[model samples]
Target chain A: MKPKSFAYVRPDSVEEAVDLLAQHGEDARIIAGGQSLMAMLNLRLVEPSILVDISQLKELSEIGVRDGAVEVGASVTQARLLAWPELKARAPFIALALPWVGHFQTRNRGTVCGSIAHADPSSELPLSLRLLGGEVVLRSKKGSRKVKAEAFQQGLLTTARRPDELITAVRFPVGVGAEGAGFREVARRHGDFAIVAVGAVKVAGSIRVAVGGVADRPGLLELPAGGSEAERRQAIEDFAWELGGYDDIHASARYRRDLVRRLAPIIISEAA
Target chain B: MRRIERDEIVSVSFELNGKRAAGTAQPRTLLSDFLRQTLGATGTHVGCEHGVCGCCTVMIDGVACRSCLTLAVQVEGRRVETVESLAGDEDRLNALQRAFNKHHALQCGFCTPGILMSFTDYLGRNPKPSEDEVREVLGGHICRCTGYAGLVAAVLDAAREMRGETEPEGEPHAA
Candidate 1:
């Protein structure tokens, strides 16, 4: 399972990194923390002609909070986010979900923006981004654009980011009174990729729920304006039906729908 | 910021077992292979050659990470502590290793190095971890021999030894 031969480069600045990516386009792949990319590389699942290692870019490693928004840089590791007290104070749900992202070791090097960039269907980072109302900043030599989490994640293992674009950072608006938030996922093992995961938080005054691994991308369901607990749960069940699921070796579409139907209310209630 | 051509060999220098170790590896070579084949530090075994197995766990710059997932060239100027560093100059077993023997924490012995390295790193920060905390740390690893009962005991025992506690009693899983 050795990887194919590939050229390697480490750009010192974000601009230079983007320039290199623009020069290579689809032939180049960016490696930030190298947690997920290295595994894929070892398995030969992806073979880029040029490998751009961005782990050394100092500009992308700093975590900043401005205008009441937490901006996680592309090189910010998952462990680094968990270490920041502001993250827990600003968004408790993200803090709760970080521990489940991976094991202690992988978290030490796995980047939050890298997880978002990878766009795994069952990942907790993407679900947290969507439920908390986050934005992904994509940059290229052409210019830059901010895409919401809902739109940035295009499909399973796919994103709205172009080949030449570099995800400079991702910003999640601080939770206003985001207390009592909760996250849970059912995985075969603690560190294994989740079969189905749910993330919920109190945004403004309403409880927003996002379900992962049930469809091509994590979906944010619209709750009724006002209803009893049972009625809201029924709406969630119906919403689960609208989310498209497919049969795979891990779970059947029907089973996944049931999981969403059962998991949504529990997590939403916990967030309350 | 050095750029290399395709399949170019690069020299990687890192602190291994508190000493400088230098070797040459292609960009694709994993740190686990570099330690075993290049440096002859086979104590870091590769069970799955993937991140899940945890058999290749080591201390990189004081943080425990799976060597298989880390590229060899990535360890440039980094400090690495393998299982070989656990023993003293006289080759005496460390407290954790001694506890594992007393508690029957290992049978196949393939998963011991990773578990020891992981617990060694964990116990350093948390000298007195509770059972649930230990289990949470252990959850990151997989052992097919069903030796968890003994493994958990070894961790708690090692923690007690580190904390300088009195004669310790093993948990229900203790051998």
Candidate 2:
């Protein structure tokens, strides 16, 4: 099946891409790998008048350690991220969930920033990022700004990004002391979107668990460091109640809440 | 009558099967359609249009990708090789292909091209991958007929052959 007709423009630099997006406003879409956007276009879920192909922009395809953190360019593919030695060491959570992103073929073309920008509630990257307190760098013709992962995603498939903005990079802070991370998701089949996914990171004296696919956006719960078993159990119940899962076609809200209550403690215990 | 000004279809020149070729296509046309319809290379099949069914797999810049989902124009100036290009004119199958044939790994042959391309790329990268590693990488390809036992043996056999081991005699077939 052919996609709807749309104008295509390949910009040499991110500045040019941002300008094109600004010119087209909401009618323009920035495409890095075209992994998610192409599928959306084929499904007619979105009809952008112009597709700004930024895949050739080498500046946005880098992975480097800087400022006591690791900054991954928006165009970095999931496959590349999985193979990145530095990222595997610096952010083990990203590594733990990288295999679950998609099949190797899909990961070959899917970009990290594209996944984050899509903000699928069931996606692994967003949930992991939120749990690790990652930040997204948004670029526009006017300037650039950063947003915490927690605040970046407003709802399912919804983000704080504007029509004229492009996600240039995602930064993960260093020094998560004594941190152990775990990512687990239940899906009907391997490589399928998760029915419910959980990413938990335990650092120093605190624990953070981010639940996805059961809520509109990734829901994060913070447990005090070195809590008693009773306190931890109470926190788990309170977090489950706070989630207020939505009933969807995949699973009922009640089932999701129950799973969260059941799985959160296990993940927390493992991390702890 | 209003006339529709045809947008210019960009000419994309790339190396396919070690030969330089060029074609003009719409910006959004997928690589699978370009290969099958435009270039008349039907060896690559499309199973699930989504990326799941690896039937449309092809080597783009030495990496396997689902041609059904990859835009053809994206491969401009890049080298692409399909399953048809795996062997020379002698009709001799590559190690992986020969292993697939000897092990009777394929039932309907619908998923052979993708499986071949993926395994070929895998062996190129890791000639000595463990059994679990093979499963980890090839888990993306689905074969309903063979139940993946024959496919796994084929990969392991190919790995052994690449390591200069002669083909084992009367290899165990899928039970």
Candidate 3:
């Protein structure tokens, strides 16, 4: 399971990295902690001519609040984000979902922006970002642009990210007053990819529910909080049907829908 | 930035188990392969090189990580610890290893190295972890023998022993 031959470079700055991307275009691939990309490379799923390593770029490793949103740099590892003191107070749902991203071993080397850039349909970070309406910061040699999470993640293993663009950072809105967050996923194993994952956010008498692993991408639904239990279940059921779960080796479409219908309400209650 | 060509073999240097180690690697050489094939530290076994199986786990800068998921060039100038570093004073097992022996945590022994390295890093960070937390960390590894109960017990026992909550039980060499 060896990766195909590829040249490797480590850029000192984000600008240099973007320039490398622009120069190499689709021939070069950006690697952060490489928790996901390395596996893909080993599986021969991708055969990039060159790899740009960004893990050592100090400027791309900061996790701080900027303009009322938590800006996580491209090099910020999942373990570092989980250890961030402001995480629980800022984006609690992300904090809850981070533990389920991968095993402790992978989390030690996986980058937050890398996961979002990978755009795995069943990944927790993208699901949380979508539910929270986060922003993805993409930078090319020409300039930088911010795309909303929903637009950034286009489909399964696909994204709005261009071949010549580098994801410099991601911005997640800070949780404001009286917000509640909860996350739960049913995986065959604890560290494995989720068969069905659900995240819920309660804010200002409204619940935003996000479901992953059942659709082409993580899907989000917003519902008023005044509904009765039966009504809430019906709304969740409707959302599940809307997702149109597909059959895979790990789980069937019916099982995934059943899980969403069953777990969404419990997650909502947990958030409440 | 210096770019190493795909076919070029570059000299890579790093601290392996607290000592300077050097090797040659191509850009695509996995750290697991480098450690075992190039450096000849075969204690870091390779299984399911796609990072699902935890057999290739090792410590990079004191954090547990999948070596299969890491490039050999990435460890340049970084500190890496493998299963070979666990013993001290004439190959005497460490506390965690001793605990595993006491709990009969291995039958095939292929997964033990990775499990040992993982818990070694884990116990250092969480010296007083609960049983559930231990199980959660154990969830990272895939073991076919002993059904993880013995592994879980060993981790908890090792944690207790490391925390000085209990004395070493029986003979140190007993199985």
**Best by the TM-score measure:** 3
| Candidate 3 or 2, higher TM-score | 3
In model 1, the runs with Cα more than 4 Å from the true position are: A176-179, A224-226, B167-175
Give every candidate's TM-score on chain A.
0.96, 0.95, 0.98
Which 10 successive residues of model 2 chain B have the least lDDT summed?
Answer: B1-10
User: Could you tell which candidate, 1 or 3, scores higher by DockQ?
Assistant: 3
RMSD of 1: 2.8
Write model 1 residue lDDT over B54-139, tens digit each, in one string. 88899998888889988888788989999999978977777888888888888888888888889888898889999988887787
| Alpha carbon lDDT at A224, candidate 3 | 90
Model 3, B1-175: lDDT tens digits are 7689988999999999989999999999999999999999999999999889899999999999999999999999999999999999588888899999988999999999999999999999999888888888888899998899999899999999898999988668743
Could you give the candidate ranking by TM-score, starting with the highest?
A: 3, 1, 2
lDDT by residue for model 1 (A1-272), tens? 66788888888898899999899999999998878888888888899998898887889888888676889999999988998978778877888899999887788788999999999989999988888788999999999999998899999889999999999999888873276677889888787788889887765557678889888889887564345888897888787888868888888889888888888888877877
- Which pairs clash in the backbone of model 3? none
lDDT of 2 by residue, B84-175 (tens): 89865876677777788877889999998998998788788888999887876677787888988888998998889889887555533332
Candidate number of the best lDDT? 3
Q: Write the per-residue lDDT of candidate 3 for residues A1-272, one digit (tens) a residue.
A: 89999999998888889889989999999999999999999999999999999999999989999997899999999999999998888878888899999999999999999999998989999998899889999999889999999899998999999999999999998883237888899999898999999998987889999999999899999889788888888898899999999999989999999999889988998887
**DockQ score for model 2:** 0.34
List model 2 lDDT by residue over A6-31, tens digit each: 77777878888888878988998777
Locate the minimum summed-lDDT window of 10 residues in model 1 chain A: A221-230
